[model samples]
Structure formats: C-alpha cells, structure tokens
Target chain A: MVPAPSPTPMGRPSPPVPARAGIGLRHPHVQRLLDERPKVAWLEAHSENYLAAGGPRIVALDAIRRDYPISFHSVGLSLGSAEGVDPAHLARLAMLYRRIEPTQISDHLSWSVSGGVYLNDLLPLPYTSEALDIVCRNVARTQDVLGRTILVENPSAYLSYAASHIPEAEFLAAVAQRTGCGILLDINNVYVSTHNLDGDALRYMRSLNPESVGEMHLAGHAVQHIANHQVLIDDHGSAVAAEVWHLYEQALEIIGPRPTLIEWDTRVPPLPTLLAEASRAEARLSEFRQTRIHCYAE
Target chain B: MLSDLQAALRTGLLGRDDAEARAAVANGDGLAPDARIEIYRNNVFQSLVGVLAAAYPTVANVLGEAAFRTVAAAFIKSRPPRQPQLSAYGGELPEFLAALGATRHPYLPDLARLEWARNECYFAADAAPLDLGLLGAVPPERTPLLRLSLHPAVRLLGSRHDLVAIWRERLGGGGRAQDAGGEGDHYILISRTGLEVQMTELSAGAFTLALGLKLGLTLGRAAHAATLSEPAFALEASLARLLSHSTFTSFVLSDPAEEVRS
Candidate 1:
C-alpha cells in the first residue's frame, strides 16, 4: 500500500502567485531556473513532470518552490472524459500537490480518454447538460481529493459540439459556479479557437465572470494552412503573436488583475526568450494597472 | 447524463461512428466538424507517438520515422493507454514487439525493454545510502543476519539472450555493432545516481543476491542464496559495492518483532 503523503506545509500558503506575468517551468529551463532564478514573479510547472517520488529534478523543483510560487498545471486530468477520473492519476497528482504545496493547481477543460483509452492529448468535449454534469462532478471530486479548489483551464479547440446548449464562456462559468472551482483562463486558447472557428474572441472574453477567473495563460501559436483554410495552432513554440497580446491586453482590461502565465511548451527557445515573453506580460499588467488608476482619478 | 455524457464524449473522440462524430462536431463556420475532429485526432496521435518515440529512439531509428509512427499508431490503437502518464504509456511495447508480425529484427523487444528500464530508472525515487556506521555497529554475529535495504530505484533484470551486449552495442562505449559470437545469457543491475541513469552487467550470483536483498531478505539469507547460486561468490565485495553505489539506503534485522532492529 502507498504511504500517506507528507502533509501540506503548515503556514500561510505562499502569497498567491502575483497577478503578474510568470512562465511555465518546462524541463529545458529547469537548470536555468535554478541557476538564474530570473526576475519573473512566479513559475508554474506541469504536475506530471515532477511526479517521480525522488530524483534530481524533483529535488531541483523542491528547492525552486522555496523561492518562487508555483502553480501546478496538469494536462492529464481528462476532466471531460466520460469515464471517471483515473484514480491512480488523481492519487499521484494529489501526492505531488501535497509535496509541492503549490499556490494554485490547475488542469485543462478537455477530455483525453474515450472507450477506456487515453489519448495522451487534450481532446475536445461537447457543451451540453450531460457534459457539464460530468465535468462538474469530476472537478468537485478532484478538488475534494486535493484538499483545495483547483482552476480548470479552458482548452484550445478545433471543433465544436452540435448539441451544446451554452456558449463556451457560459459553459466554463457554469462549471465554476456549480463546482465551486475557479478558471485558469488561457487567452491563447480563446484566440486560437475563435480564429479557427471564426467567432468574436472579445465577446467570449467579455462573457466570462472575471471574479471567478483564478489565473490567465498567454502563449504563442502557429498558423497552419490546411487545404487553403488557415487554422491557428496553439503550438506555444514561437513568439506570442501581436493579436494574442492585444487580446491579452483586452482581458487585462476586463479581468483587472489575476496571475498570468506565459506558456512556451513546444519548440522551447532559450531561457531568455521565455523570460522575455514573461517580462512583456508583466509590462502589460503594469500598464493596465496604471491606466486603471488614471481612469479612476479622472 | 453524467456517465452517459462521458461515454458519448469518448465515442466522439475515438471517431468510431459518424453519427456520434457528427454530434460532436461544431457547426460554426471556418471549422468543419470533420476538420476539428481531425485536429484532435492528429494531436492525440502525435503526442502518444512522441512518447513512444522518446522511449524507443533506437527502435524509431531502426524502423525509420514513418514506419515507427505506423507501428506506434497500431500498437496504441490495439492496446489503449491505461495510464494517464505518458512515461507509463509504452509498457506493452516489448510484448507488442514480440507479436508484431512485421519486425525485421528479432532483438528489438529486448532493446525496447532496456530503454523502458532506462526511463523507469530515470523517474524512480531518490534514496540515501545506508549508514555504514550503523551497519558497522552491528554485532559481528548478527551482521550477516541483518537484512539489507535496496534503494527504491533498484532494478534487476536477467535476460535469456545476450540482450545485454545488444544494449551495450547500441548505448555503451564499445559503439553500435552487433556481436553474434558474443551471444550468451546475461544479467543486469540498473539504478539511478542523480539525474542520469546507468546500467551495469552483473554476475548471475551477484544478480540473484541483489534481487534477494531487494525483496527484503536478511543479509545472511541473501548471501546464502548468492552462495547457492555460485559457491565462489564474494559477499564482502558485493556488499562493499552496494554500499559505495548507495544502493542500500537502510538496513534492518530480519526480525521486525525484535525491539532492536539495527
């Protein structure tokens, strides 16, 4: 039998990840993160990356978590799966969350499993009462086991569900309200899905209840030309496009301030590149706050 | 609606039937349902394929990129991933290799196993070395009676063929050339010492003794098993190696009921 995990470190949880620009702590940058401890306000790590019971990487993360607030982002939760959440995966995640004591924990709003098979990739889910019910229960159960409310991230999508009753923002808002969880708003996903499906990205952004949003994500994507039709790919490899940055600025305008993470998962560039992207996000947040102060004074 | 809704979502992802597929697709312009589904299908295939490719780079090299992907897709489809972690995704590849009718190379399965072990050791837990001082304080009479504790990262593998040589050829300093004349049964001890994982060949007796110790055998019993396997085995030297390698993180007397466990 697995031993009960070490308890969450007692104390005030590290101050919530600042509502400033942070970076996703991917492996390529682990050493760099330790060595430089760049000026980024906080860092978020993929939960599965540190699932090992022990290792040098785990040790490094343990050390880094001491200095930087961490947000444990999960890709494998399969929150929208018809099958119940994978208990082993949940247990492992719970164990890691306990050990890390991250300021915030999050997973995607997508399903990765079907017919007893895991796709190992985030799959799209329909927006219906049934889908919403499955997602809400899973979210609540996940939060219960982890002993904390988690932020469910909206996924980048290429397809839509015909039987869906609610709009995407409403679906997410409903999940947040029903489950008492929060949202990790991935602005790139909204932009990508919006561009791919030809919808108003700003409208989707405006519809989300800002107070319920726990965090925000900013990432870069690629434009894939498929058979003369262009699809925006959430590749997270290249530089954040100007339009997404603009959308992020718009989100900052509406949402006020929340923890923002600059994600660069694939085609990861040098550490400086990620930090630069994060710095850009920080500047935007600073500008947004300054503008709010000016408008209020006026 | 909860479980059934989840089931419907799954059916749509698997792309099993068009009616379910149609229901899953978004009717919004610019993105057709088939196209959206295709995007997801590609993402799923690409991600899992990347996991397999990482786990079996040599296999991928041997089969070439396209062929490896073809085989990986089939293996994945036939044997769906049970574990959410991608590191745990390819445990069945060795068995799959054994049954894959089109493999030009017969030894690929063993190599895949070696790579899998490498990954396992890479991600296994860290452990401190057993305290030599504590073991030294043990009364000489009970020293041999003490049970040795292996690190959680320890793995002992005994293969029927010279898969060890094959692994070394692909990965070792000797370079990548198969030695048909070097074929023989082989044993191995794989462990992690920091971030890097390494594999070392072991004698049959040493391997058996280490395996026994790993299973929580007392030092005396494990040594006895080692001697039974090979009369000329050196227990002291092996213990010293394990101690130096930091493989034995802790030790205890075989009898847990006893108040004095040291």
Candidate 2:
C-alpha cells in the first residue's frame, strides 16, 4: 500500500502553526495520537522530555512531526538566570531543533536553575531592570544558538519582589521588544499571578503589546489558602477554570487570536478529555476570527 | 544583585527558610512574604517528588504513598539533580534508598535498582544485534578468542532477593511472591529490543557469562567463569537465547597471544 503523504514534509523548515487551538503532547498521548490522529491544530512538546537520541518518544515524535506542526515548549532554558544560560543545555536544544524543526519554541519568564542545580520548578523572577538586562541577554543568546526567535511566557506568581519595578505584562513586553522574541501569553498564568499578587487581571492583559505575542496557553490552576488569603497555584492538573476561561476570552479580544494551547500536565485525563479542552479554545479562536471578518465586512 | 537575590530565594525554597528571602519578597494581597516563599517551596518539592514517583511507581507501590514521599523528599534534599533534563534526575535513587532503608526494608533498594535499570534501558540507543551466523567465516580454532559487546541498553542486575518476582507482584501480575525473600541470588538481564524492553531472569551460569563478557572477557574465558559457578552450564543454549533477541551488538575476534596465561 502507498503511504499517505505527511502534512509537513521531512527535511523542510518547520511550517508555521495555525491560529487555532492545540494540546501539549504528553508522553501518554504520543502513541494514541499516532493511532487515532486526533484533530488538534498542532502539538506542543516539552523539548527536554524528547531530547533522548533514541527512544520511544523520539521515534514517535518523528512519525508525529510528519503529520502535525509541533511547538517546542522548553522548561529548562532558565532565561531569567543571572548565572547565564547553560551552554551545554543550549547545545542539546539546538541539536533537537535541527532535527525536529518545530514551528514555535518557548520557555517561561522565570529561572529554575540555581547554583548549578536544576530545581525542577519554574521559580519566580523579580522584574527589576537588572533582571530585565539579564533576561534579555539570556534570551538573545538563546536565539543566536537556536537560529530562531523564541517565545517567553509569563509565569504564575505567588509573591511579588520588593524590587520588581516593572509590571508582569510590561516585563514580558519588553523582553519581546528588545530581544526580537515573542510573548507566549499564558492566560491561566495571568489569572493566577494577578489574583495572587493583587494586580488587576484586565489591566495586565491590556498592558501587553499584542503584536509581539506569537502564541497563547490556557490551563487550569489550583487555588490554595496561603496565610488567610487565597492563592492560585499554576498546576496544570485539571480542566480550565471558569474564571480563567473568561480571562482567556478577554485575551482573545485584546491580543487577537494566536496558536492557543490547552495544557493539562498533572493529572492528565484521557485523550478525549484533553481534546475537548482544546476544542473549547479552538471555538474561541474561531469566534475571534469570525468577529474580525464581520468587522472588515462592516 | 540579581544572583544574590536568586541565591536567597534558593535558600528559602530548597534550604532552610531564610529571613533575607522573606524580607526580599513583597507581602501582597494579605499573604505574608514567608507564606509566598512557602508556596514556591511546596511547588518545587512536590513536583520533584512527583517525578520520582513516575520513574519508580513500583517502588512507591512497595513503600506506599506517605512513606515514599518522606523518602523522596529526603532524597531530593540530599542529591538534587544537576542536569536540566529531569529524565536523568533520579539515577542515584536506588543507592540512596539502600543507604537509608537497608535495615528496615532490605529488598526495597534492589527493587529500585531494577526499576532504574529499566528506565535507563527505555531511553538507551537502538543498535541491531550481530548475526552470530557470521561465525562461520571465522576459523573454528579462533572462535574461543572472540570478544562480544553487549548492546548499549543491556544492564545486568544481581540481587540477593528475587526482584523480578517482587516487581511482577507489585505491578499486579496476580499471584503472591512465593520467594520474594533473600533466599537465592537472582540475576536480571534487561535490554531494549525494538521499542520494547525485554527483561528476563538469568541462571547463575548465564549471568556469569554475561558479566564476564561485559567486563571484556573473551568467549573462552567467559565460559570458564560460567562453568566455575555452575557445573552443568549449557553454553550453546544460553548463547542462542541471548543472541536471538539482539542482546549483544557486535563481536571482535581477538588474538590468543593477548590472553594472560598461568
């Protein structure tokens, strides 16, 4: 039997991701996706998870990469580090990028590596000008090595730095404006960080330079009590919360539509449950496109 | 200044909570600075412990959730991962468990070793097994001088306990472990063959041969080692079973002159 043609052919540069909703490609879903071929607009992969040279994940990713546009969402970039981005990590990422050719790549606007130890969590970064310089330097260095622009995502915060001079959105905007990178506006993080830090969610959303955003992420967060007040924890463990979904709709209005993603990492349910979340985001993106079309028609 | 603040925050989260970190953070939305740092502290520890749980679910199953979390938290504090790739993080866990809980739970460490080996084999590079049929090309007299290379994914784990049986039982393989105790020495040969990891218990003679070969012993010398352990060791049977599944990647014919003679 003749093999079916792949949407994105091998050996070509990665094709751009469409302005629709996709899902984070967790390990459990890789084989199911191959067998079922679910209709997600694209798949976003954690770059570190797939760096092994020869493994089941790598093999599946090669087959899956042929059929779907992939986005490389990395957690280890540590762009906010003052110690500089790890050169060895950068080289490994570069190797994977050359092989997979993902359409979009991203990391958080936070540091996780400290004193040469990977803490394995996205630790918050103070938005001081000094941090801004360090982040920009690290981001620019990353772009130079990877030979493509990377998107920096806003992090979910539990506390503010006494020294943070810039707002979260403006800090991300400046990172995009200065480094020639783009913002991967994570709406759930906006809700969690603002609600936790006493910032107005609407104002933070409006503060971003919408054109600088290349992609968007929506996920569920957990609310916990911290010293008599409610704090939202950005644990991608469940369905997108109603309030976060509303914030996502507001983001669609302000930033227009980008390649949105629904991430459910912690207690990742079955594939259909995740696909349903992605479809909801897809519906919002479709609605945004329709509204723009109507505006042009009027 | 940026590095200093980071160090303080690191100390607050991973190390004992420091007053400097609490002061460095801004108290907002009725949450104290220490409480904020606690939030991050919980995240860092919980996520890492979660990673260990995924890698060694059988270990967690054996220890139960609360006990495993305690052990995992202590392991995290002691030997935190230096690599960015979290997949490579918990390689030291088996040895760590042995050091901590050997007296209380003797079999737990060996069980962890088996799981860790299987994890490594899963990500190891794929290499096609050599066709030993090509042995026809070598002169019959020189067959004993041939040295073999095990596949990159091959790992031989020897324990006093029957880790394979315990692992099976814990993974819901049904029947209880009739001999899960440290009764006889058990050897496990683990290797990835074509996307699936194949693990089988090896006999004394077979394990000795594999270990000898892995330590660069020639075929004749390895057979000598195997026969030393088991008088009735069947070389041809074991060789056929191992070679059939691509256990060894390549073989080199060595000169008899290189052998150290008594």
Candidate 3:
C-alpha cells in the first residue's frame, strides 16, 4: 500500500560518481565537512543513516549532497533474505534514492533478515542455484523499484557452509549475468572471507568477469584468534590493514579502476586520517587511469 | 530449502542454543560447524547490542555497563529488530526493563521511556508549524470543530518520575534531582529543532488536552477533556504555550466519511 516515490529530482540523472577514491560521510565528521569542505572526489553515505523523515542530520545530508556526488551504500536491503526482501524497506530505499539522486546504490551479497527478524550482521549464503534464484529475484525487484541497477558486494563471512557448491566469484558473476547488477568487489572482504574459509583469494577473483565490476570497497579488518583458530573480521573500525592495502592494489590492477570507497565504520578516526586513507586509494586509482590498463581475465 | 536453512540459522544466532543451526552448517577446515555458527552468533549479538546501547545510552549509564549489557543481551535475543532500520530498533526497551524486574533504580523504566521518546522525536517526520495567523481568521464558531494534527516530531510523555531533571543530570548538565515521592505524575513535552531536543515539563491539564488532540479529538472536545481531568486547567495560557512550542502541524479539514470517526 506504499505510495509511489516522486520522479528523480533531475529529469536526467546527475553525473555518476567519479572513478576516484571517496570517504565515508559519517556523523562525527558532518560538521567538519560542512565547515571545511574538503576536496575529496566524492562522498558515500550509509543509506539507512539518513532515512529519517526530517531532522538536522537529514538537513545536513541535503546540504552536503549539494556539494558532492554521493553513492548510497545500503546495508538493510537484505537481498539474500529467504523470505524475500522486505517490501517496506525496498519502498523506503526507493523514496530516498529518488530524493537524493545518488550516483549509485548497493547492498551486501548476504542475508540479514529471516522469519521477520533482522539480524544486524551480514550473514553468508550457501552458494547454490536455489539461493541464487532468491537473490536474483530480490535484486530484480529492487532494480524495478529504483529504476536502476545496483551493485552487490561480497560479504566477509565468518563461516563456511558445506552446502555451498558454487565458488564465490562464480556465484557473483552468475548473479550479475542473471540480474543485470554489477559486482562491488570489496578487496578486504575478499581477503577476509578467503582467509576465514581457507579458500584462494586470487582464484576467487579470477572467476569474476572484470566488466561486471562497477565499483570497489576497501576497508580495515581486525585479525582475531578465536578458539585457537585465526579469523579476520571485517570490522571496518580501523585503517585498511597492510594486507588489505596490498590486496586493493592488486584488485586495481585486475578490475582496472572503479569508484572506490574507503570505509572506516568502527573506531572512526579523525577526518584527516580518513582523508589520508582515501588519498592512498586516490593515488592508486590515478596511477591506473594513467596507464594502458587491461582488466584481469576470468 | 533456503527458508528452512535460514530459519535454522536464525535459531542458531538468536536462540538460546545453536544446536539446530550448527547441524545445518557444513563442518570447516580446522574448525567444527559449532565454532563457525558460534562466530556468526557472536557477530550478530555484538552488532545488535551495539545498536541498543546507542539508542539507550542513559539507561546503560544508569544501569552501568555490565548490568546494561545483561539486560540488552536478553532483550535483543528475545526481540531482534522487526525492521531493517536499526535506528528504530530499541522501542520496546522500557517495557522490557519493567518485565525483567530490573529494579536497580525505581525510575529506570520511566527514564528509559523518556529516552525512547527523545529518540523517536529526533528522527520523526518533519512538517512545517501551523500558522496561527491563518487560524485566527477562522470564525469563532468554526474553531470548536477544527481537528489539529500534531507535529511529527512532537511527543507527549507522562511519567511518575521527574525525567527531565534526571535526564539532564545524567547527561552531565549538573542539574539537581527533585524528590518525586509526593510530586504526583509528571508530564513532559518533547520536540526537536535542528539537532537539539527541547524538553519542557507540562501541567496535567495541558498534557491531557495535548494527548486528546494528538489522538484526533476536535479542539472543543479536547479542551473539555482537559478541563474535566483537572478542574483548574487554564485553556488560554496552555494554548498559547503549546502554540509557541509548535506542537501542532496542521488542522485536518473534516471529511464527510470520517466525520463519524471516533
């Protein structure tokens, strides 16, 4: 019974997010962003953060959106939910996108809702065709509602399922082919999931078609020893780890270059620290742009 | 099959035990399925609890970290967010506190209620304030039948505890707590402007009138209810004060169909 969202603010869409590094538009740095207005290429916001009906935060986002191109990195779409995506959540997202006219939008490859309960973490899915159908159905429905295709990111999974038969990248590539969505290709998540599941990270990347990639995410992860076994948690609380940074460089070499975002969600450091991390990503992206880069073959 | 697996996984993550969820998972390289499922359980709890902590910081402060975590863990396990928006996740916490016999502080539930109200008001829908000048032009006879629509971000909170003083003290404004033993019921009006949430204590009669209007009663009936609740309720002064606070959003014109609406 939800009403239709208004048409996209601009009859024609604004320019897409630039192929350069962008920093996360977090709450703590909102004031500094308004006052200082740094020269970052673009800004990415967690869509759920600005979903309020009316508030100063919403006002701030409106003002900031005027200054920079934005991409909404949504976590609540829950594309992998077994019961299907929540209609209300999808409708709300559609409204927000129409209002903001974000350059691009995306959600994780995992599920967070089951039996009407919303689990906060992005839990992994068994890479089977049945699950693939559910994901495609959800993604298609979302795209139909938004009137645009969205990219799906690889999630940092803590567990491996024996029922999972299809390889991770192959599963993603299949999703892209079936749903017309693109891959987000988080290098840190690639490292974290592969490390936790004892899979080959490079081999996983090799299965994905480089052309299917539309954007990239790089974030810091925490290494922890649980029950005498080491697992890398994609906490997004600190700087992009050295291993993740190296993985990001290799991804740039493979994927060519895309709108890369540096996400530091947890112990969010100062603005300069985040901007510095973004500058590192910017430097690498600039290097890729300067060269005769060929995407990695599947 | 995916639904059954996800259902079992839900039980695994939020249930008291993960036996069913562990059975659903495939065992690991150098790790058992139990340990793998346990990892997700830990992640789910950590993130969900973090959401609750942010929503109910004053409650956490009053209860201290360890006790608050215990209540939060129990509350979230039983009541995982119904919606994907974690911002709206912790609404049932005050009721949950009362149900748990979490009587560490007598005013804890009311304080938690006030906090939830503030949270809701902060993020509620935005609407422009009703123009008093326009309303004044209405004929006096027509005014009695006019129904007022309350602002989206306005909330009327009634408690036995002096929540404003307590909230201020806990927020480190250095306000002294008032003795509430014989103070009767407390009515608080909460509305937000910009990032600041303004809290003003209201009289019993004014609260009654505001509550009636919020519940869709016409102005005359709402005022009548207010005066009946408190025989000394002053309508003129209370109306002026509520108007100054921008409590009402607009006046809903009567529809013939909803005319019979109770």
Sorted into a CAPRI-style docking class, model 3 comes out as medium
Candidate 3 C-alpha lDDT tens digits along A174-259? 99999889889999999998898888888888888888888888998888887898888888998988888888778877767888
Best by DockQ: 2
Chain A accuracy of model 1 expressed as TM-score: 0.95
Which has the better DockQ: candidate 1, or candidate 2?
2
Highest lDDT model number: 2
True contacts kept of each: 0.75, 0.82, 0.78
- List interface RMSDs for the candidates, in order: 2.4, 1.1, 1.3
User: RMSD to native for every prediction?
Assistant: 4.4, 3.6, 4.1
The digit string of per-residue lDDT tens for model 2 on B94-208 reads 9898787455557888889999998888888778778767865888788789899999988999999988878877876244454346588998899887889888888899989
Q: What does candidate 1's lDDT look like per residue over A36-137, in tens digits? A: 777889899988777777777788888898889888899888898777688888999988877788888889888876656777777667688888888998
Top-TM-score candidate index: 2
Report the candidate with higher lDDT, 1 versus 2: 2
Writing each residue's lDDT as its tens digit, candidate 2 over A1-298 gives 0011123334455667888899999988887999999888899999999777577889899899888988899999899989999999999998887778788889999998888888888888888899999999999999889877888999988888889899888888888889888888899998888788788988987988888888889999887875578778898999999998899888888878888999998888999999999999988888888988999999
Question: What is candidate 1's lDDT per residue for B142-254, written digit by digit as tens?
Answer: 77668787887777777765666666565433544663425666877778765667677777678878988888777777888999988889988877766665677887776
Superposed by TM-score, candidate 1 places the C-alpha of residue A145 at a distance from the truth, in angstroms, of 2.7
Question: Model 1 off-target regions past 4 Å?
Answer: A1-12, B1-19, B27-31, B160-175, B178-181, B255-262
Q: Find the number of clashing residue pairs for candidate 1.
A: 5
Report the number of clashing residue pairs per model: 5, 0, 0
